[model samples]
Target: MAIATFGLTNIHRRVDITEGGVLGMVLLLDHHFGIPPWALTTVLDAACYLLGWKVLGRDFLIRSGVATLCGAIFFRLWDATGPLLPNLSAQPLLAALLGGAFVGVGVGMVVRQGGSSGGDDALALVIAQKTGWRLSRAYLFTDLTVLGLSLTYIAPLRIVWSLVTVTVSSLLIDFVKTVGHSENRQKA
Candidate 1:
């Protein structure tokens, strides 16, 4: 998709779209508007950090930390590279699809590993635990809210693409985790 649009295939593909990465992407994408992405990212990271220590224990927190850091770093790289690529209007749909998929996968991996990317993701888990709803459902609710907020900075269509990307990413993560669990049970 990227190749056809910008002749760039590895731009966002290599970033890994973890929570931090997504935060970075959010910053990069919205840099023109002077949005305070670091402020948000810091708060989210603190939340994840606290959750990692208190709610999820050290082991899981470590994994989440790794994912968050990876996401953030990759996001920065993507931001730096943004100038080289065509702007969103060049291929908005493709950008949205890939962007959403990248971030969603990052979120799923962190969550599946018993951690979170941050912000509403952590809040979603807390809500799920307290309210007894499924995690995926909680994630969906959270994503919907985020998608709505995204519309303020981006085109309506771009917001939709982000939603699609996240949805696909989450599904893929869950599928992998579920299969792994099933395989483990069979071995047992």
Candidate 2:
């Protein structure tokens, strides 16, 4: 969670390479409405978690709640420090790769533990459970939806890189889930 948020605050935000799903929505709202992402993130995450709790049950809620709380705290702590990573505005492609790897590993670990790092994960989990789609496919669906909407404000070129980032991260998340869990062996 920390690594993912660091990449988001440091690399993605600085490089103008947005992601898909909840964080992407947060960025979108921030860009268009001048709302602080930290506040919006909390509200959005809580809403999605409530939806997820109704669908996924109590244990899932408890686990995901802890992870989400930790993720939020870490995000604020990192945000307060400002972006310490080297500027990547000139190298969007590299930023995309690094950002994807960080988020993939971080969120993947949480999902592997039967939890979610953010609202997107909870929503994706619900989507997968409800639709019988693989988790990665669910992630791609949600991500692409947000990325498509991002076309309204963000450049098409940046969306191209975001697509790459989401794809890599989605694949890696599934990869991590499949590594040690036979029940989660569905391939990306």
Candidate 3:
């Protein structure tokens, strides 16, 4: 889903709007420091996974590792096949909405399974554990922070749309988590 979001954003010619996590930070670095987003995301996600191991337990780390690996592979594959994909540049809003949905569903699925795609998920979990906040709230806070910082580089209108994408993605993530937990509770 993350890869889909990236591809959609690229195809739409819109500023890449990501769910705030290490991915967002990497994008910022790419824009500001000329660092490659893939390399930075990998390193940052590895660090986040290490932190997850300490704070979220071994099982969490293992599952997150799987999610991370899958994400990396998918991203690479998407990059390789991008040229053959359909162009959606004519419909930026539609692209943003669909891209956000894909990201929300993808991340939410990983998280519902006691796994994370690393980066923001791990950080959000840690914050929720420590602060007794909802995971979605934690994610929103982090995402907003990144978007706020992004204003330095991204155009104002683009940032607004990015915020819209992030907001939609966050809401869907919360919905997925809530539905999953409710089902689990009923089973219990």
**TM-score for each model:** 0.59, 0.85, 0.80
- Backbone clash total, candidate 3: 0
RMSD of each: 7.2, 2.5, 4.0
Sorted by TM-score (best first), the order is 2, 3, 1
Q: Where is the poorest 10-residue window by lDDT in model 1?
A: 1-10
Choose the strongest candidate by lDDT: 2
Cα-based lDDT at residue 11, candidate 3: 42
Predicted structure 3: lDDT? 0.71
> Which of the numbered candidates is closest to the native, going by highest TM-score?
2
Query: Which parts of model 1 have CA positions greater than 4 angstroms off?
Result: 1-35, 72-91, 182-188
> lDDT of each prediction vs. the true structure?
0.52, 0.85, 0.71
Cα error, candidate 2, residue 30 (Å): 5.9
lDDT tens digits, residue span 146-168, model 1: 56665555566545555665566
Candidate 2: list runs displaced more than 4 Å: 27-43, 76-84
Q: Write the per-residue lDDT of candidate 3 for residues 91-160, one digit (tens) a residue.
A: 6576667666767777777887777876788888777667777667778888889888888887777777
State the weakest 10-residue window (summed lDDT) of model 2. Answer: 179-188
